[model samples]
Target: MDFHHVSVLLQESVEALNIKPDGIYADGTLGGGGHSYRICERLGNNGKLIGIDQDSNAIAAAAQRLKEYESKVIFVNDNFANIKSILDKVEMNAIDGAIMDLGVSSHQLDEGQRGFSYQHDAPLDMRMDRRNTLTAKSIVNEYSEEEIRKIIFEYGEEKWAKRIANFIVQHRQTAPIETTGELVEIIKRAVPAGARRDGPHPAKRTFQAIRIAVNDELGILETAIRDFVDVLKVGGRLAIITFHSLEDRIVKQTYNSLSSGCECPPQFPICICNKKPIVKLVNRKPRLPSEQELEENPRARSSKLRVLEKL
Candidate 1:
């Protein structure tokens, strides 16, 4: 299958970055190089772009797409959470802007074999890197019922988390949940008929929860935000596009906490902790995709772009 993904909030995110013709930029989740291509187009000969992705497919497709601008582009196969170390290895002290588009890419879902979508009946393998030891199969079949419930509730925001976890644990005991179809059946059994009909697939949230746990998506996002902000030069920007509320919340909270000047007590007359704001939010609210973009690609519907500029 072709490694294809329509970059979410493409123009909006690049605009949020406020790219400079001669400055350095990084696309930490360079999916199919959609946004990265646009960034490279706006750059001068002196400008540089570092595209990083853990998925080998993304790296290959992006490399081919960006070959014309090869002199100005560098590609790496790694997770965005290692942005700081990546920049250091590339001899970049600080970048002018960075972008992170979090969530499973459209390619991962549409490919069918990657097992990111419950709509697909492939093997239960949702490892983003394909190199990771942990797989959705292990997460679904081996995790304790309580742990499964926690993941579904916290990561997936599924109201039927406990029931779903219980069902999974009960069913998997008969045999290991080895395929997406098997898990989907379990989820269908757990959710009420009316509830399942009203919304998305009954297994959607559970699949999301399992994939996230397998990849440590949320944990990586939390760790990456601080490092990404630290690597930004004064006045540099970090624009993140998140596809789910949990991911959006992390980006929003991280931006807010960094932009907040100090955490000192209200009663304190003089400053003591001396914590300073690192970045200022470009917009108080996240930028959502326009109606036009949504019409063109339904996957862009849940995306929210948040931007922060280094202080």
Candidate 2:
């Protein structure tokens, strides 16, 4: 399958980076090199851009799309959570800016074999990097009812998590939940007929929850955000685009905490905690897609872009 992904918030994210002619930048989730391509356009020959993605397919496709700028680009096939180590290996200490688009690419969802979409009846495999051992099948078949319930509720924010988890556990006991279709049917049975009549697909949230758990999406994001910021030069910017509320909340809270000048209470007579603000929020509220972009691509609706500048 062709690795294709419409970069979410394309123009906005690139502009937010405020690229300089000779500055160094990183695209932490270099899917199809959409944003990275634009960043390259704004760079002079001396400028450098590092692209990283866990999926080998993304690296290959991005290499093709960004071939013209090969002289100024470096591609790494690794998780963004290892940004610090990757940067060190490349002999770089700090970067002028970095951008992370935290959405499963269109290729992942469209490619039925990946099993990221509920509409597809493929094997229960949702590993972003095929190298990973744990998959959606393991998550569904091995996880306890309570564990599954918490994943659905906390990650997917599905109100019917308990019922859904219980249903999955009960059905998997008879036979392993081997495919997306089987899981979708279990989800349908879990949701009430009335509730199932409207809204998104019954299996959407459950599938998302399982995929997140299989890939450790949230855990990596939390760690990557801090590490990304830590490598930013003074006045360097970090822009992140999250597709889900849970991901957005983590980004927002992390940025806020880092931007906070001090942790001491207002009543404190003297400074106890010597923590100083590392970055300032570039935008008080996350930048959302415009009505025009939404019309062009419905998937862009959930995207929230948050930026911070290093102090």
TM-score of each: 0.97, 0.98
**What are the lDDT scores of the predictions, listed in order?**
0.91, 0.93
Clashing pairs in 2: none
Tens digits of per-residue lDDT, candidate 2, 90-135, equal 9999999999999689888998988999988999999989999999
Worst 10 residues of 2 by lDDT: 1-10
Q: Which stretches of candidate 2 lie over 4 Å from their true place?
A: none
The sequence of per-residue lDDT tens digits that candidate 1 reaches over residues 41-99 is 99999999999999999999999989999999989899989988898889888899999
- Top lDDT model: 2
Clashes per prediction?
A: 0, 0
Q: Model 2 Cα displacement at 180 (Å)?
A: 0.7
Reference-based TM-score, model 2: 0.98
lDDT of 1 at 244: 92
